[model samples]
Target: MTRQKATLIGFSAILLWALLALMTIGSAPVPPFLLNALCFGIGGVIGLVWIGFGAGFGVLRQISWKVYAFGTIGLFGYHALYFTAFRIAPFAETGLIAYLWPLFIVLFSGLLPGERLRALHVIGALVAFVGAGLIVMGRGDAAGAVPVLGLSLAFLCALSWAGYSVLSRRLGDVPTESVVVYCLLTAALSVPAHLLWEVTVWPQGGWGWLSVVGLGLGPVGLAFFTWDIGMKKGDIQLLGVASYAAPLLSTLALIAAGLAEAKPILLLAALMITGGAALAARASLKP
Candidate 1:
């Protein structure tokens, strides 16, 4: 696909990701780990159906366990932390914090072979960090203040995903079908965690079921595939800038769900973060 098409696809994935925070809001009928298990389980099935059993199994057999380990830690680890963060903190706050991956991506991307770390990249990373600091510290009202643990985990989610994106690029020739393995591994990991730590209550009703299904089919499942394709084929700088839009979209989703109110600080944070990320990626943003 052309870079433009790839970018559009990636942006669409961002929208689905925005919806994730809204979908998995309350806890009881489905705990964090259990939600993850269900989402990844259904996602894995979707992947399996898409690739068919024979071809999918062939790819799996060819890949090393090392690959699976990395994929699991990246994909599953990010989601687990993310879901838990939602449970502890306001979804909008946690999401903005987790959305730091775009900035981290710009920083980490320089580590790859043939990619040089530029001065603007450093300056921009610092600027973005400052923006994140503002977000973390800018809770002028007690109603929206995020807990320390939730804040920390959200940042960890960013770090985990940034590492994942860079590593994914480094791992040459891994097929898009690799998501199937990641989803399956995540499900396997999540099952034990859910059984041990969480009470296994199924989604309460149609709304709950819809959330699980939407997560699986949209963000957890198809979004991964589209993102992989975009990262491989799209304009890097463009995608970097585009990624910042996720926090805004996610925050908007929260507002629409009546789960959050629009805060001026969030807009300022968005500007700072997006501008900083854009600065970091300026070298590649050229047409």
Candidate 2:
């Protein structure tokens, strides 16, 4: 299909997996680091399956080292910081701040070569930000600075994520698989470090390890693979607009998992974000 279609599909998959992640499969009875490593490692393996079946090894070799290095490291940094925030702060607070990556895209898009982000982008960003605010506030979790450590790390996660969004475009010709490889490789690098310092590391128990596996294979791995591949097939502008669908879907997933209480206010916010993102997507498509 077309690149825009692929992007839309990819982003939709991201939402699906994000929902899975927020759902909590068995129970989180492990440390964040161990669980993160397990997830990344498993996710990496699943990504390899994509390479093996569809993309191929030659594609992997053809990808730029720069893309591989930056993408891998960038992803690694994002997860590390993000999970750290979870350890230190409340989930709602960390998640809300972390969602700021969409806005980060707007700020960084200008510096990107050929992506002069039109006025519509600015408006869309504001709309999405508003939606994020509703999700954060609607859940009864205000943006407080009480969890100093977790909040600070959460802030770092947002910054890192923003940098990744801006920088990934530089890998224009690199295979999306290569970026996936970078992530897997980064995960591989962490295993050794984890084996050393930590005690009851993330994967402390079977269920905890399963949680890691789910995160890696579904959200982090499979979700990204499809999303990037889809984006590669679609218009970047349209893809950008569709990306907002992830958070909205994620909220729905949260409600199903009992993490989110169904309230008229939050539902309204989700609708607004959805509408705003749809409009923004259309704006990018029109002359």
Candidate 3:
């Protein structure tokens, strides 16, 4: 695909992720690892059906085991760290730290072979981060003693995802189909983790089940596939800057769902994020 088309496709992942908070709330009472297992299991099945219809199972065999390993570590490790961090730390602070991945992606992409680190990219990323920070901090509960370990893990969570995304550019040759193995392996890993750490609890109702399906089908499933395409072939830096929009959009989704109150700060965040993305887009388009 053309770079523009690939970038647009990657941006779709952000759109789907916007629904993550809303869907997760709807799927409530399911513990994190159990929820991880269910969603990734559904995501894996979706990948299986996709491959079965188009590329056939044979395509999977052509992929290297290392690629599968990398994908699994990226998907599973990031979530594992995130869940653990939240378990230990206050949600808002931990989430703010974890959400640093986009900025990290922007910074790390500069290290990739063909990518350049432009001033505007950094500036735009910072601006967008401020917007995302406002949203996260605004939603935060009253402050308490800092949980150092949790904050550290949350930082690692950012690094894990940023590293995964940037490195995907290096493994550009790997087929997106390989994410299926990643999802399945992640699901397998989550099962044992759940068994050890969490009690079993399924979705409580049809709405809950539908929400789980929604997550598997979109945010946790196809988002990865499209993201691979974006990282491999699209404007990675632009996508990095644009990713900050996820928090803003996610908040809007929550408000629309009546889970959160609409706030005046969202307006400023919208402007900052929009301006930041515009700056990044300008930089990307320059000759």
Candidate 4:
């Protein structure tokens, strides 16, 4: 695909991720690892059905086991660390730290072989980060003593995702189809982890099950595929800067669902994130 088209596809992942919190709430009482297992399993099944209808399972065999390993580690490790961090730290603090991935992605994209990192990209990333931080911190949770280990894990969670995204550029030749393997392997891994750490609790009802399906179809499933395409062929820096919009959009989704209250700060965050994305887009447009 053309760079512009790929970037737009990647941006779709961010849009889909905006429903993550709301969907997770709807799927509630299901523990994190079990939820991961369910969503990734559903995502994997979707991929399998997709492949069966079009390219067939032959395409999967062509991908290297190394690629599968990398993708699985990226998907599973990120969720594992994120869940662990929140379990140990205050939700607001852990979440704010975890949201640093976008900033990290923007910074790290400069190191990619053909990419140029302009000043505006950094400034834009920082501006967007501030907006995301406002949303995370505005959750009104009381702050307690800092949990160093949890904070460290949260930082690593950011790093893990940023590294995965940027490194995927180097593997540009890999088919997005390989993400199917990644999802399946991640689900497999989550199954054992859930058995070890969490009690199994299925979705409570039709709404709960629908929420799980929604997550698999959108945020957890298709998002990775589109993001891979974007990282491999799209404007990575622009996508990185634009990723900050996920949190803002997610909060809005929550408010619309009546899971969260609409706040004045969200309006300010909207402006800041918009301006930051505009700056990044301008930078990318420079000849």
Q: Which candidate is the best by lDDT?
A: 1
Winner on lDDT (1 vs 4): 1
lDDT of 4 at 123: 83
- Which stretches of candidate 4 lie above 4 Å from their native place? 83-97, 116-141, 145-155, 263-287
Range of the 10 consecutive residues with the lowest summed lDDT in candidate 3:
135-144
- Candidate 3, residue 215: Cα displacement in angstroms equals 0.8
In the range 67-170, model 1's lDDT, one tens digit per residue, is 88888888889999988888887667788888888888888877777677788888888877887787777776763555989989999999998888767776
- TM-score, cand. 4 vs. native: 0.83
Residue 176 shift from truth in candidate 3, angstroms: 0.9
lDDT of 3 by residue, 16-67 (tens): 8777667766787788788788989999998999999989999999999989
**Which stretch of 10 consecutive residues in model 1 shows the poorest summed lDDT?**
20-29
RMSD of 3: 3.3
Question: Whole-model Cα lDDT per candidate?
Answer: 0.80, 0.62, 0.78, 0.78
Tell me how many clashing residue pairs each candidate has.
0, 13, 0, 0
User: What is the TM-score (0 to 1) of candidate 1?
Assistant: 0.90
Better of 1 and 2 by lDDT: 1
TM-score for model 3?
0.83
TM-score, one value per model: 0.90, 0.76, 0.83, 0.83
Model 2 lDDT per residue over 1-287, tens place: 66646666667655654554363333355555565567777777777777789968788777667667777777777777776666666554455556555455544555566545567666766776676566556545554536667656765776786677656555555567775686677777667656775566344477555666667767666766665665355455555555556546666666776766667866666666565656555555565
